[model samples]
Structures are given as structure tokens and as C-alpha cells.
Target: MNSDAPRPSPRAIASLLVLSCIVGLNTVDRNMLGLLLPQIQQEIHISDMMLGVLMGPAFMIVYSVCSLPIAWLADRTSRRGIIVCGLTFWSLVTAATGFAQNLVQLLAARIGLGMGEASNMAPASALIGDTFGGRYRVLAMAVFAAGGPVAIMICYPIIGRITAEQGWRAAYAFMGLAGLGVATLTLLIVRESRVDPAHGKAGTPVATQAASGIWRATRQVAGTPGFALLCLASVMVSVNFGAMLAWLPSFMVRLRGLDTATTGALLGTYKGLVGVAGSIAGGLIVTGLMRFDQRWLAWAPMLFCLGIIPAELMLLFADAPSWWHIGLAADTLLMSAITPCLFALLLSLLDSGLRATGVALYLLIFNLVGQSIGPLAVGMINDQLSAAWGTAALRSSLLIAPLSAAAGAALLLALAARLDTSQAAPG
Candidate 1:
């Protein structure tokens, strides 16, 4: 992927906005399952472990596994085409989720959704890097990345209402149909463009690396400085994110005695609205820090991870409204730093030609191990302790998320230390 057009052009800005919207749609479609878990549970009668299985392995297994090949294809082919096809396919799968009659059908639908979404982030993230280089790239990526929280802010309340009034199935159908429109818009608006190969940061040598077989590309990506440590950090941080997002509504409903509407409103304000703020702030903070030292890319996220550990713990255990609000706001803001920082560090580090593959591998480990383990661990804890302590069992179970977040912070510190002595892995 290469580009010659001025990065600040109106057309480029519009394209980025459109692409970001598409990414947000992807988030809403994927996480809608977690959002409506209570409604789904009422209809399907799933155990906590089974819920974990559905949220964790059943979806993420295919999501993480299939992304590698899709990313390889994206690296070599047309990214916009792949994104269009994927969004369309996943939207259909999301709608298909409404037709699920039992847990088996739901599982099948979720797997299909995963397979479709596997094609999403890598290509898009890589495309953004291609479009906007250097400091601007991080900010652009931050905007794109905010699609997650923005989607929640924009869609969660509506979806919650739909679930409360029309049922979870209706919410599923609504989101799926909405995604089809978004896909069509993306197909119309976003164009595939390439610039001189010389424009790439790593240039001709790296281009050859992408053309080589997958194994060599894998090694090249894996060998990039701080790449392994970044992956480790992502894996750890995603554990907390995965559990928190997946269980948030459940947690609110079961422990705080909130209904779906109330929970959605609360989350939309805190996790979604505050989260959107955090994303932009992360980009701005890192971009400014990079003026002094690129190592700040690693350092900033380490600090965020440390901040999130205690905030998440407070979110889980604090009984006072003030502490809960402070914790939730702080966690959303601090945790928001991780994705942009990680992706910015990753895209900056990798040669342009193989970005999708590198990102895919990073996501594979992050999701397959970290995200899977978090929700599963929490659900297992819930099942084991629910009888003894009831809904409060989840409060205890959620403690693991912060500890895992701490582990992520430790890895980021290691990455920063490595960057201290090395000249690589930076803007």
C-alpha cells in the first residue's frame, strides 16, 4: 500500500471518515452479542461457562485464525474490496444470528460472524497507515480506532431499546440491515490507490519480503523490534478489555440492579462517550510525546496500563457511586490508550508491504489467548461461585481482569526499556 496525494486533502479526510464509520459498524455488529447477553440468556438458557464459550472461543477461535490468511491476501491484493466483501458477509451473518433457535444455531452464527470479521481490522489499519504517515498517522489511526467506542455510544442505547421492546432478535436484525447500507457506502466512497513503491518506509527490500512466502513474512514480522513485547502487551490488555466489555452489561444488571435500558445509557455515557474522548486524547498525547522521543510510544501505553489496573479494580469492587463513576471514567480514558499506541507502534515498526500479516499475527495472539481466557475465566468463576455468593460472584471474578492488565503494563515497560537501547519501533 502506497499513496502520493497530500494527506490533508478534503477527499482524503472524507475517505478516512467513511472508513472510520465502516469500522464502527463492524464493532457494533461484533459486540452486539455481548450487549444483549441478558436477553439472549433468557431465551437460550445458557450456563455461564457456555456463555463464555460463545463469547470467547466460539467466536474468537475463528476470528483470530482466519484473519492471518485474509491479512496475507490484503497485503497482496485490494484492501478496500476485501473490506467491502467482509462487511457485507458479516452483516448477513449478524442478521442470521436472529434466526438462531438454540445454542447450537447461535454458535454457528457466531462462528460465521467471526469468519467474516476476520477480514476487517488489519486491512483497514494498514490502509490508514498507508494514507497518513508519521505523527498524523497516529492521530488518524486514533480516529479510526475510536470507531469502537463511537459505535457503542451511537448504537448501544438504540439497541438496548430494541431489545427491551422488540427482543434481542430484532436488535440483531436491525444492526445487520444497517451494516449492509454501510458496506454499500464504503464500496462507493473508498477507492484503492497506490503510490510509488519508493514511498514506503522500508522501501524495496521490504516489498520483496511481502512477496516471499508466508513463513518468511511471518518471521520478518515476528522479528521486528518490540513486536513480540507489543503482542504480549496486547494479549494481556485485551484480557481486561474483553472481560470488561463482554460482562459489563451483565455486571450492571446482576449487581447494580440496572435494567438493560439503564445499563446501556450508563455505558453509552461512560464506556462509550468517555471512551471516545480517551481515544483522541491518546493519539494527541502520544503524538506530542513523540516530538521528544519515539520511545514515548511504548512509555505512554505502559503508563496507561498501570493506571487502568487500579481503575478496573475500583470499577469491580467500589460500592460508592463516586468511586464507581471515577473508576469507570478513568478506566475508559486510560484503557483507550492501548489500541492506538499498539497499532501506531506496530505500523511504524513494520515495513509497509507486510503490515496486514504482522497486525493479523498480533491480533491472533491477543484474541486467541488473552480475550478468550478473560471471558472464560470470568464465566467459570461466576459458575463456581454464583451458588455461594449469587451475583456478587461476578464482582470477585472481575478482579482477574485488572491483574491481567497489570501484566500488560509490565510488558509495555519491558518494551520501553528495550526501545531505550534500540533505535527501532517508533514513529
Candidate 2:
């Protein structure tokens, strides 16, 4: 390698990692609530529905509504500054969550936390998309995306441990402090990417560029076949992803009789390490295969989804004891590995100009509907059936995940079939 050819600046790498940690920490905070739910509920006198509201509507709705505006700001202002301020705000809120004396206080804090978190991804994504070009962009995005899993690995277990020893409140306080530190680092390290001079501000203001309203950007994206299909596929992916994130640890404890710490470790290992490997591998593989054929966008998801079926079945019926652990592990790996390809496929659909909005929309549907609804629905099902089947009900609820996954596979396959094989990027 030509070291003299101006390698990616150390500052850039530091910024990216800090951005990654910021993302990781955010997810960690989110997942900590789930991991410590039993304790939090018992202490705070909340119901499962309240848990749903805290993790779901309180957090996601605000986050989803705000993301576009924040991304719009990123388009119009400094991506670095937006991300730094966003991180600081959320970090403080995450800490404040610990001090909540009742549901109202916690709900308000989570909402504030949601608002802060909303700013992190869109601009950070736009920044990474701008900083690295083409194939490396996919890889860099994959590395940054790994923040989800890596944060899960570190944060889940840490929360589990803290909840065991210092209590959930202490865990929340610790996470908040961690977020503050990361936000400070982001302020110092992350530099804004150079914007195209022709555009009035950060690049082109997404709203002004579209003659129509903000909905216009979404409508334009929806009109594009590949982009539309990718977004649809993303929602399906999110359903299963959400189920795993919010409930699997709980499921393991209730169904398999694992302790909270063990459940966290299991999820962190399979979902974090294995899933992250899959994400990075998916991005790199698609980039390499695209050198030969662009159809890899469709092909990767088709193949990855196909690979998950058996594992999904294993998870659905793992109570028989013979295949429980094996099935659980495989499902974990399958879900993790599939994500990188899913993201790369979505990115491939948009022109460079629309990537931020495109990514934001992808996230909007994926998070708002899939992440927000999937877990709550599953939880509702478990709660409803817990009286009839005891703890076995949670396992039954997970069946929805794989069934949705299969439907997602069908959607991606149909989309891939329609893709033009012509060797050209969209102009």
C-alpha cells in the first residue's frame, strides 16, 4: 500500500470509531432497558404495556419523526456538529433516566433520549457515505453498522452485570456517563466531510431540491423500483431483527431457564460477534461480487434469507432439547450475517444525491413499523398466552419472526427478479 498516497486520516478513523461507539452506546441504552426489564418493572411498578410504550412509541415515534428533519439539518449544516450535539443531548438524557422517580419522569427522559438519538444515525450515515466512496463506502458503512452488534455485546452484558450488583438505576447512570464521554470525543475528533460547492449548504437541501414537500422525496424514492423494493425488504428484515433485540434475551430466560447474565451473554455472543461478522462480510462480499455483476444486490439477500429458514425452524421448535442450543446459535448467526447485505442492497438503490434521505426512509419504515411494532406485538402475544401455556408462550411468539422473515425473502426474491441486469449504475 502506498502510505505516501495520503491514507484515510487518523482523525477520520478516530471519528468513525467514536461515531461507532456513539451508535453502540445508544443501542446499549435501549437494550439495557429490555435486559433489566424485570427488575425495572418490579421496582418502578410498571406493566408490560408500559415497557412497550417506553421502548416503542416513546422512543421510536419521536426518533422517526425527527430523523428526516435532523438529516435535513445535516444536509444544510455541519454533519459533525449535529452528531456531536445530538450525542451529548442523548447521553445526558440516558443518565437522567436513572434519576426518574416514576413513570412520567422515565417516559419524559426516554422521549428526550429518543430526540437525541434521532440525530445520531442519519447525519452520521451521510457523513460516512460522503467520506468514503463506492465499495469502500459499503465497507465503512458495515464497520460503522457493526456498532449495533458490538454495542449489544458490550452493553447487554454490562447491563446484566450492573443490574445484578448495582441495580438498574446504576446501570442507567453508568451508560449515561459513557455517552457523555463519547459525545465529548465526537466533538473533538469528527470533521465534517467537504460538501459539493454547487449545493447551497451541506450538499443540496433535500426539501428545496425537491419541488414538492418532504413527502416528495419519499414519493420519488418510492417510485423507483429498486429503491422501493429495497425499503420493503428492509421492513421485513427489521421485524425479525426487532424481535431478536427486544425479546430474545427474555425468551431465553423464561423458556430455557437461563439467568439474566447468561441470556445476555448468549445473545451478545451469537447476535453481536456472529451477526457483526456477517454484516461486514455481507458488505465486502457484495462489493466484490458487484465487480462482476450488480445483480448481487438481489442475489445476496435471496441467498442469505434462504440460509435462515432451517435455523428459523429450529428456533420455533427448539423446546425438544435435542436441537435447542444448536438451533438458537444458528438463528443468531443467520440474522447477524444477513444485515450487511440488506444495508448494501438499500444503498445500491439510490443515486449519491438521495442517499441520506433514502437511508433515512429505509430506517423510518424499518424502525417505526418493524422495530417499534414487532416486539410489542410479540410481547402482547406472550402476555396473552402466558396463562395458558406458562412460559412456553414466548417461544411461540418468536414464530412470527421467521414467518415474517420468509415473507421478506419472498419480497426480496421478487424484487431481484425485476432488476435489470444491464451493467450500469443509475445515472
Candidate 3:
């Protein structure tokens, strides 16, 4: 692949769009649990710690554990098939979640959901890299990344309202059924891009070379000091994000005195829109800055992380609803900006054949520290503080998120300082 490859064609763009939509649906199903957490807690009579288990460890453990094997398959097989099968399976499992009558059943369904989602990021990202070469690849990925916020924007109001009227179970079933449509479309429309010779060679009769190549690729990525710093930063940022996703809505409902509908609407419109803008802006800014100095990729996210800390602090302490909303919007904008830049930087750290496996490893570490532990830690903290803080326990528990962002900023700055600008990866 050429670094100066031509812009993606209409067919490529269409495929990207469909794949992005699938990504969006995947996010919507995953995040809907957060939106409906309060209701589910009320109905199931589970404690905060139990809710954290369902939202965090139960889902992330399976999601993280399965990612590598799935990514390995994706690297050697049809990426499209992996995505379609995962999508279809997860969607159906999400519907099964709606039928759960107890916490154990819900946990089981969530575990299945995690297994299904395990097939997504590595393959989807690999596909994007193959479809959109050169500088446009970053922008295309930013578009794909926008799917999460977009899903929130579209699903929040609809799911929130449905949960208010029809119940949380209905929201799950509806989202699950809707995903089946996306799965069908993906199966029909998304074709696999031509595999690189390095990847094709993995399928050769000699298994030793394939294993050796994978080992060498892993060693190469692991040996990169800058990539190590990036992963540290990613873990910190993911901690903040995971904690927020698990508890923010509940915080609003409890501390800010907003109902679920109002909370969803505000977040959907304000946070979602601002986040989408930030993602696009960050991609453009980082890519443009890379034209002058590649270090800007790490620096941009560092600055964003530093900026987000104050916004998050304000959100935690704000007394007025207007002030709280303002803080949330600002925090979300800065936080969202960091993702595209971080992902682009990660892609630049390794060879093309290792991209999917590299991403899976990144996600594995990210999910283990961030998704599996972050929310659970917060929940445990909230429970511990409840006696002293009462209704304010959740608010106080969230203070750790900003501290994580601060650590992330420091890590990013370290990464920027160490980044070798002249050793840019090939497209």
C-alpha cells in the first residue's frame, strides 16, 4: 500500500459507511445497559456492586479474552464473516438479555454479548486500513469511531422514552431486533478488501513461519517504548471513560435531580453532538499537524487530556443543572477528541500485517484495566462511601475519573517526548 494512495472510491465509502453503522449498533447495544441501569437495578433488586459486575467485568472479561483469537482469525480469514457472525450472535444475545428474570441470567447474557462484541474492533479497523489508504485512512477511521457517539445520539432518546413507557426489557429487545437488519446488510454488502501478501502468507502450508511471524510482530510492537507509553495513556483514558459510561446517568438522576428521559435527552444532544465534532476536529488537527511533525499525534491527545480534567472536576462539583450540563459537554468534547488521535498513533506503531493483532492486544490491556476494573472499582468506592456521603457518594466516587485523566495526560506527554518523528510507519 502506498502512503500517497488515491482517495477512497464510492464503493469503498459505501462499505465503510455500512461497517460504521454496524459499529454503531454494536455500541448502542453495549451502552444501552448503562442507560437502563437504574431501572434494571430497581427491578432486579441488585446492589451497586452487582450492577458493576454486569456492566464491567462480566462483559469486558469475555470481550477481552476472546478478542485475540478472533483477531487472529480475522488476520487470516474473511474479516467480513467474523463481523457478520459476531453481529448476528450478539444481537440475538441482547434479546435474550431482555428475557432474563434474575441477575445470574442477565450476567450470562451479558457474557454472551461480550463474546459477540469481541469480534468487532480489530477486524473492523483492519478492514478500514485496507479500504482507505494514506492520510484518508485516519479520517475514515475517525468516521468509524464516530459511530459510538452517533449511536448514543440516535438511541438514547428512543431507548429512554421506550424504557419510560414500555420498560427497559422492551428497549433491549427492540435494539436487538434492529441489529439483525444491520447484520443482514453487512453480510450482503460488505466485501473483504484484498489481503496483504504478508497476511496471505499466513495461510501457507508451513505453519512454523506463520507462528514465527506472529511472534516477531508481537515482539516488535512490545519493544516499542512509545507504544508502551501509548498503552499506559490508553488505559488511563479508558478508565475514565468506562467509569463515566457506567455511572454518569445514575449520577445525574440521583445528584442533579434529573429524570431518566431528561438525562438521556441532554446527554444525547449535548455530549453526543459535541463528541462527534471533537472526533472529527481531532482527526483533522492531528493529521494536519503530522504534516509538520509526527509528535503532534501524541501531543494533541495529551493537551486534550489535560484540558478535560478541569471540565470533569467542574461536573463533579457543579450545584446547578446548567453548570453540570456545561461541564459534561466540555468534558465529553475533550475526551472524545483523544480517541481518534490515540488510535491513529497506535496504527502507526506496527506493520500492516500485525495491525489487527496489535489492536486486539491494545484492546485486551485496555479492557482489562479500564473496562473490567474501572467501573467495578468505582462502584465499590461508591458503596464504601455511601454511609458517609449518602446521596453524594456517586458524585464523590467520580472524582477519581479526573485524576485518571490527569495521569493519562502525563503519559501522553511522555509518549510525545519519546516519539521518533522520522520513523513513521508505512501506510
Candidate 4:
């Protein structure tokens, strides 16, 4: 830790809390589309493949494309300002989704939502890195990663009940409007940190390196064998995780004959409670293990990825709802453990100056390849198999998730071999 870096203050803690809420809001806005997919499909009269497109590529393409530039701006300027603008923009666009009458309108709204959310992760990750120091850093990141599961927990039941009574549009409107308040709070409370004078000098090697532009930074990061493998592992894990998240509610409703409300309550509780527990536990366990052997960073996620394959398989093939819930909970628990560990590893590989760009590049790959293709692939598979398998098509289509998890486990194991754990600390 830099001796000159200020100790954590109340304002810094409040800023992290605000940032976590922003992350949670982003997750709710993005995942709510998937939660409301069945309703949206009925109203728009779209095919499963089109629903997949709407869920995946519609938002992700814009998000992936815009994230790099927005992240670049954050690396150079005010991250707080970027977040305020993004929060406001996405909130309005999310609310506008309620007014969409057709596929084109919905798609446009989603594109705007994606553009807005593109400002989130990279800048937020950089801010968190700047805010917290060693030892506390991983735990802080775990808390940050908890935002998604926490959002899912809160949104699922509320949105589910609202969709049941009012409509999916109303749910979208309600959540969207609520986000503006968070944005307002963030604007009022969060303050940007001043860069160290030494860090600002162009003559400094770190500054010169980070100033080389996005592609150059990307290439330099990719040049590392371990980091490249970690990215590949991330893509595989995200494909499995993203596909399951997008399709799980519909699968439960259609295949298990559960009501939307039931599906929401069940998943919400599981992700909220179990998921948060797993993230924190995983962060603590990995942080403890890092003191002995930093190789546990990759090994922990590898083990979790392997655990996901069997749990997901059981979830997909099971006949009983209880069995399904159990499988889902187990899967969520294991998968939740991966986020903090993987992010900690990624941050550990980069310097503070390039962390935002590195995170942006990683997110670009994750969204572009994983988020963009995963759901689409599942939907395509479901459509193709429907003629023969009927309702079972969805179940069979989900087999891809477990297979992707297996690949992720393999990739992580490979990544562990290449990483030099002793030198894994941030440059």
C-alpha cells in the first residue's frame, strides 16, 4: 500500500455503498428483461430465437461497444460524473421500456439502456480499487459483487408480483423510476479522488504505458499467458452463467408448471441469501488461502466451476420442483463464489493506472462473446429441438450450460498452471 494513500473514511464508505447500489440497479435493469421475458414474448408475439436476441445481443452489443470509450473517459476524468450521467440515462431509458409497443421500440430502448450501463463496471471497479487498500480490497470487491444477487433477490418478488397484477411494463417503469433517486444520491454524495502527483507525470513509466490507448493496453494485458487464459475462462463461465440466468424463470414456468410469482420468490431468495453468502465466504476463503498460496485464486474458481456442472445437470433434468430449487440454489452458491475470486485475480494482474481499461476490456469480451451469444445459442437450440423434444427442448437446450461450465473449469485449471502466484500482486 502507498504510504501517502489516505485511510478509509466515512465518506469513502458511503461512496462504496452508493456505488454498490448503482451496480445493483444496473443488474436489476438488465436482468429484469429476462425475468419478464415470458410476458414480453406474449405481448410482442416473438419466437424464442427473437426473445434470445432481445435478451442478449440487443443490449450487449451496444454495451460492449460503448464500454471501452466510456471506461477510457473514466480513466482520464471524473468517474463520479460518468456514473451520474450513466445512472440518469439508463434509468430514463429503462422507464421508457414500459412505453414500448413493439419489438423495434423495445430493442431501441434496450440499446439505450445498454449504452447507459456501459459506463458502470469499469469505472466503478477503478473507483473501488482507488478507495480500498490491500487485504481489505478483495473483501470490498466481494461486497461490490454482492450487488447483482442482492438486486435479483429484491427485484424478483417485487417485479414478479407486479407483473402478475399490473404488467411487466409497470414493473419496468417502477424499477426505472426508482433508479433516478439512487442517481441523485450518488451525485450529491460521491467525491472523486485526486490522483497522486507522481502518477500524473507523463514521464512516469506507468503513465506512459497506460496512455498508450485502449487497444495497446488490451494487447499488453493479453500478452500475458495467464491473463489471457483467465479471460477465456471468464467467457466460458459467463456463457453458462448468463444463459442459465436468462432462461431459468421461463424454464421453471414452462417446464415445471410453476407460476411466475413462485419462480421469482424461489429464485430471489436463493440468489439473495445464498448467493450473497457464497460471495462473501468465497472472498474470505480465497483471501485467507492467498496468504499461504495465491494459486488458490484460480484453484478456488476452478473447483466451483466443476461443482456447477453436476448441480446444473441435476437442475435441468430433474422432475420435482423441490429438486429443481435445490439444484438451482446449489448452482448459485457455487457460481457466486467465482465472481469475487476472478475479479480479484484480474485486478491483481494490473496496475492502478490501467485497472479501468483492463476491466473494460475483460467486460467487453464477457459481454460480446458470453452475453451476446449464450442466450441466443440456447434459444436457437430450443427452437431447433422443439419439433422433436417439444417442452423438453428447453431442458435439452440448457445442457449447453453444464458443458460450458466444464470447459470453464478446464480453462481455469490451465490458467492456474501459467500464473506465478508469488508475483500475482498488482504492478
Q: Which of the numbered candidates is closest to the native, going by highest lDDT?
A: 4
RMSD of each: 2.6, 3.5, 2.4, 2.2
Clashing pairs in 2: 275-336
Error of 4 at 352 (Å): 1.2
Model 4 segments beyond 4 Å from truth?
1-7, 194-205, 208-212
Q: What is the lDDT of residue 231 in candidate 1?
A: 89
Model 4, 289-374: lDDT tens digits are: 87777788899999999999889988988778688778988899998899988888887786666767778888989889988888
What is the TM-score of each predicted model, taking all chains together? 0.95, 0.89, 0.94, 0.95
lDDT of each: 0.83, 0.73, 0.82, 0.84
Runs with alpha carbons beyond 4 Å of true place in candidate 2: 1-10, 194-208, 211-216, 319-322, 421-427
Per-residue alpha-carbon lDDT of model 2 for 177-294, expressed as tens digits?
A: 8888887888778886533233345555553477235667667766656776776777887877777677777777777777877777777776678767877777778777777666
In Å, residue 234's CA in model 3 sits off its true spot by: 0.4
Worst 10 residues of 4 by lDDT: 193-202
Where's the lowest-lDDT run of ten residues in candidate 1? 194-203
Instruction: Tell how far residue 26 is off in model 3, in angstroms.
Output: 1.9
lDDT of 2: 0.73
Residue-wise C-alpha lDDT for candidate 3, range 389-411, written one tens digit per residue: 99799988888799899999999
